[model samples]
Target: MVQTTPLVDRFGRVATDLRVSLTDRCNLRCSYCMPAEGLAWLPDERVLSDDEVVRLIGIGVSRLGIREVRFTGGEPLVRRGLSGIVARTRALDPGLELSLTTNGLGLVRLAGPLAEAGLDRVNVSLDSIRPETFHRITRRDRLHDVLEGLQAAADAGLGPIKVNAVLLRDVNDDQAAELLAWAVERGYELRFIEQMPLDAQHGWTRESMVTAEETLERLEKEFVLAPAAEPRGSAPAELFTVDGGPATVGVIASVTRPFCGDCDRVRLTADGQVRNCLFAREESDLRAALRSGVPDAEIARRWVSAMAGKRAGHGIDDPTFLQPDRPMSAIGG
Candidate 1:
């Protein structure tokens, strides 16, 4: 049954999407994402099992009025038997719009299988078009593999394929136009994201930050851009199409242009914690309850209770704003 009363928060924003972290482990060490070393991985036992994850997602869909489910990870493809998880989640609600955000390293091999299983679409992290730049940003030489994976995903019919590029000043910022052209040429929607303060190293400063306005100024110099019709609800990206062309670009200006007012995304960590906002300081431990064999209805009620305390905004701009203890990888972004 569709939930009559959705997960509405203090601000009256009803969450229709849930981003679930499949694992807190990843293969790449992006400079902006995590440190080069000295990182500890989550114990295997701490992560949610496929059955547990599916059950939680089902409750969100059937009782909490969640219409879309997005699987994220340090890199979701790293988890074994991922297609099984995807198939199980899809089975819960035939109408659930399921998607994933991946670094694209393993999609070359798993794209077709995952598509066949029931994945609706994919968002690939492609920071740069230049191989050396890609390597420099991600600290990996898997650019070739990622490129091949994009083609494989397209061939497998996993679209509309989106390329998520986190723009950093003097780093990959100069290549913004080139990256968009490359993605447009390949039929991918390229979205340039402003670097936020979610880095595990906590080294994010406004000086190194690349704002959304700067990104648009850079892109508009290369292509004609007019605001495309936005869909109803809280979508992070503001989309634009190239003049006289079908290809488009989007900007996620979370810092400069906050979207928290319309924000409707809630998150579940791989360890079974529920987060109302990505930058929330507080989290509720649902894993403990699940492991204790608590009833599913009670678990669902706990989810609603957790989100009921959703904050007004992430407060990234506040003078006293502090980065959350969990990094984006651990938080399921």
Candidate 2:
């Protein structure tokens, strides 16, 4: 028999949003995400097969009440089978909301095919518009490629495309307002995310990370922002009207101003490990069960049990907090 229980934790937050990491390999080595050389990539056998990914997503939608599925990656576009994966997941449920979080490098070629295969939207990671600053932050000089990808995605009918940006102190922090202006002019929704302790280098410091207050203060100098009238709900980014109208910007202050109280997300790493929290030190191994020929219902039960132990918060404010071993790229962010 199939399980119908929603993926809920002790905090009573039902996890309807699922973030699935397609692979642990990326094309760029952003200073904040990983080193220039990059970390070791997961072996082919360890990562979930395209079929395995679809099966798990099927269970999440048909049995576990998943409403939205967002495909993430070290860079999701690098996955050879991304379009097929999206197509298969869409076949599971026509109503299932499917999206992707990518670096926007591959979208120039794949965006049309992905949208044809049923991808509803995309969130591209773009830190700076200037080529020099972009290279400094991402260790790459592909800002022009990313810009082309954005336009390609727009031409493919991906409306309200979102750009996820992270500001580094003395790096690209001063470009917050400038990036926002660029996004506004192009009709893309820009979200500024506060740097978290998820870097592979483990160099993230609370003192060095920019805060939401500072981001808002910076934006206010160039644009008038009032809180968007819409309720935040389970979404992480808090939206603000850019100039008191339809145009808006978002700030995902994951570190300083966490929204864990209403978090409704569950993450699956590329290796098929279920992460209940982004900073979780432990993971429930779903790949082992799938490989061992366990029934789908049993796998669903294991997922439920794993989520039940989720902590009230990420505990970044705790005196003895420790960052997880896996970095943001490996953790599917």
Candidate 3:
């Protein structure tokens, strides 16, 4: 039987947003996310099958009160069954919000199919507009391909397409204003995310990061910015209107200014573990329970129990805090 009670934590936060990792594999090896050599990919047997993913999503929506679902990955487009997965989820609830986060490598060919399959929009990870800078950051010369993919997504009618960019201290930090100007020109909502400690190399330090304040300062040099009137709600990005108009940019200051108090997200790793926080050290296993043929109600109850243990905050500011073993790639960004 479906549960009417929402997935509420001890801190009174109700999780309505679900982020599902399609796979722990990505094409590009971004410096801040993974080493150029890349980490060992999850074995096929360990990763959740398409059917399993669809079933769990059904449970989350029908029983657990999930309202929005964002498909993420080391790169979601790497997963072959993504379109089918989106289709199945859409069939579950036509009104459910469905989105995807990708590196934009394969979006050129898959964007239209994905949109037809009911993907509402996309958030592409693009660090630089210059080919050389892009290659330097991602260790790949696929900037041209990513740009084409963004255009293809736009042609596919993916409006309000958001671009996620990370700034490395000396690497692309100078391009902050340039990136926002490019995004505004193309009508893409650009979000500058402060580099976090979730890198595979674990080399991330607070000093090396470009804080939200710094990002705003850079943008202010080229454009006028005022906080958008819209309420932030559970959104990670703090929206700011550029030049006081409809075009806007965002800054996700996960380090300097945490938004954990209003977090309403839960993550399911590609291997089927529930992560209550991006920086969480502990994960609740759902893959074993599914493989053992546990009933849907039991699975839902386990998910609720997992949320009940969520801490008040990610504790990144805490002196003794440690980064999770999984990098942003494995953790589904």
Q: What is the lDDT, from 0 to 100, of the residue 89 in candidate 2?
A: 92
27-88: candidate 3 lDDT, tens digit per residue? 99898888889899999999999999999999999998999999999899989888999999
Best by lDDT: 2
Candidate 1 structure quality by residue, lDDT tens digits, 1-333: 344457889778899999999998889999998998736889989999988898888888888889999999989999888999999988888899999999999998999999988999999998997989988988889999999999999999999999999987888889889888888888899998888888899999987799899999999888999788657358899888788567778999888888999988999999999999999999999999998999877888898889999989989889999999988889888
Q: Relative to the unseen true structure, what is the C-alpha lDDT of residue 200 in candidate 3, on a scale of 0 to 100?
A: 93
- Put down candidate 2 lDDT per residue, 250-284, tens digits, no spaces: 99999999999999999999999999999999999
Task: Give lDDT: candidate 2, residue 61.
Answer: 91
Where does candidate 1 stray beyond 4 Å?
A: 1-5
Count of backbone clashes, every candidate in sequence: 0, 0, 0
- The lDDT, on a scale of 0 to 1, for candidate 2 is 0.94
lDDT of 3: 0.93
| Deviation from native of the Cα of residue 74 in model 2, angstroms | 0.5
Candidates sorted by lDDT, best first: 2, 3, 1
Full-model lDDT for every candidate: 0.89, 0.94, 0.93
